[model samples]
Target: MSPTVLPAACEVLVIGAGPAGSACARTLAQAGREVLLVDQHEFPREKVCGDGLIPDAHAALRALGVYDEVMDRAFRAQHVRCVAPRGGHVDVPGTLAVLPRRELDDIVCRAAREAGARFAAPWRFVAPLLDGERVVGARLKGPDGEHEVQARWVVLATGASVPPLVAAGVCERRAPSGVALRGYVHHPELAQTLRELQIVWHPRLSGGYGWIFPGPGGVFNVGAGLTGSHATEAGGRASMRDVNLRQMLEAFASVHAPAAELLERGELRGDWKGAPLRCSLGGARWSRPGLLVTGEAAGSTYAFSGEGIGKALETGLLAAAALLEGGDDAAVRARHEAALAGLKPRFALYEKASHVNHRPWLADLVVWRARRSPRILRRMSAVLEERQNPGRLLSWRGITKLMFE
Candidate 1:
């Protein structure tokens, strides 16, 4: 239920209670700060995501003190099968699991509340409350009515939703970095057969890839993503691609036999859904005077793999740490910006590797080589664990090395 009363003031006001916002609120509240966590949707609401958790996500969950709780409920997997266009595949081993965002996010949000953060839902951020250029709070609308709440610091963690960032004057690019569509299928037989997280690349879904991840019970997450849908043209204008994701999914099934069988034999549990993605940390300013942006709002998703949950949680923790440092506004902003800058180089590498999504033959080559060379397979596993730079495996230098080695 929505909170009947909204606090007039808080030490920290976190908007958008996804992984990022909830992580921030949890950290701040655990530090004894008065935190108010608000979201436009209520708890356990459905969120579109691949729901694959890798090693980084595991680390973040451990830090948040909810690792065991999440692991207990998540569908565990040992490997991710990367399939090339020609049906070649390589299994990269890692610590992996899958739990729907509806469940995963609710657990994190509940952790925040348990840490003493005041939680409220169905409260939409209307605008930023500013004293000149510094954000003082936000005007929120809920079932009760529209109301203004004050806070020393405001955090924007709204994932892929641009309006809140625009209202707060932090949005840099109006266009999303990419787009994706996904749906769940409930077939116990299919789920039992698909033990690994499967990623498929094909020319038909250029600038993106298709994934079939096994979820708890009989559900399997199936979808395709287009990372180049909003590529910026040479003339500085956004070049929008007119592509139908539903058709793309159909094409994926046509080309990939497992996907075809899944669709043909399994029962789709819900309508297919799509969501915009912000990637490579390029679409927004990380912070201003009194506001900070984290999560997909700040482009936390990786361009190559479209994974953002771990980074979103990590960025949220960074935001909370900057506030906990107890410095002047400039100092706090500087710290947060530096933290994001540290991750920029890694995001750039992923962006470089995303070229494989557009040129899928590269994936086929890599998979073929990986199947032949144990060294290449080890590097691929490192890439998934984030131990090695993705460029080391996807760049021209990497490709040349793969051929000779």
Candidate 2:
């Protein structure tokens, strides 16, 4: 068979080439498993994101052996500067980095290919192939035509896009979650003087925040996100409402001082792009017979923060580890399900906090306090570094004492 041709079958079929899919495929391939990894777009493609890699995300990449490569090309950010409206701000220390998704996605994917996973980019997944309710593989639309491929197990990691999940009945229906808009901006300050990632708490974007992450080549990733809890209800149904995310993004920049300061002198690289963030913090169905869903397709994004990459990479590694445990199909499925369950406490806590965070004033208060008090600032840093429980921020004391005191 010619190189680049899709094989009829493999031991594992991994969809998506982003961090989650690539990581899973790399781990499986390194473990002596035949793997087929596919993505709809070619490498180095645009992915709308804040591009901020926190401690959890960095740890996952480091474990996968591609963290240093990304760091070599990324802008190293040591602290996160959280700004409240009306000029209140606090700087929390952490190990964060910014690398555009194009480069970040391609780098990890290259690692996967080097590990012996057969990769086929520019190929789209049409639907999952099923044998009496068990997924065998998926139908991939390649350059030639639609081709059916079979595998012993499938790891669905298609980030962002949800059609494949819906088509396979993996996800029946979901409520409106969150929406975000992001774009690259060219500003000389990024290279000249800017040093930290700026996270702004604004009253305009309910249950969300605006961010400015320094990037390479004099450009930085800037964006805003809004949770569905505050989005307008059209006929009282969130699914039917049309969210003008671009407008929300623009509004944030115009009001937030730090963001506006940069926008005043910098230029947006291209038109604003946006995507829907599905937060399945309430225990969405993630695994089925012969199929395990990773990444955004499984609703892995953290509520309010919209942090998915960390969770995605974590789940991807968990999926591979479960299969590597050496067991039959049923045992493998059970292991994967249990591994995923371990992450639910944090997800559930974040979900609960996100609801109370719908009150933007609370964000303003936290940011204000963090800036004024050193102890609170250190505590905030602990939360960012994952050393403290975020669920506490959702408690009654968190809502009243933390916000008011």
Per-residue lDDT for 1-405 in model 2, tens only? 222488899999998888889999999999999999988888878898778888989999999999999999999988988776666777889988888888988998999999999888778889889899899989888777788889999888876565777766676445546778888889876457778998776667656778888898889788888765434455653453444766667777787765776677788898678877777533246778888888777777888578788878888899899888968778988998788788878777777777644666666677766767787777778888878776676466775767567
Candidates' TM-scores? Answer: 0.98, 0.93
Count of clashing residue pairs in every prediction: 0, 0
lDDT of 2 at 153: 92
lDDT of 1 by residue, 140-259 (tens): 998888999999999999989989989999988888888899999988987767899999999998878999999999799999999868857886778669889999999999999878
- All predictions: root-mean-square deviation over Cα? 1.1, 2.5
Question: Using TM-score as the measure, which candidate wins?
Answer: 1
Residue-level lDDT for 99 in candidate 1: 97
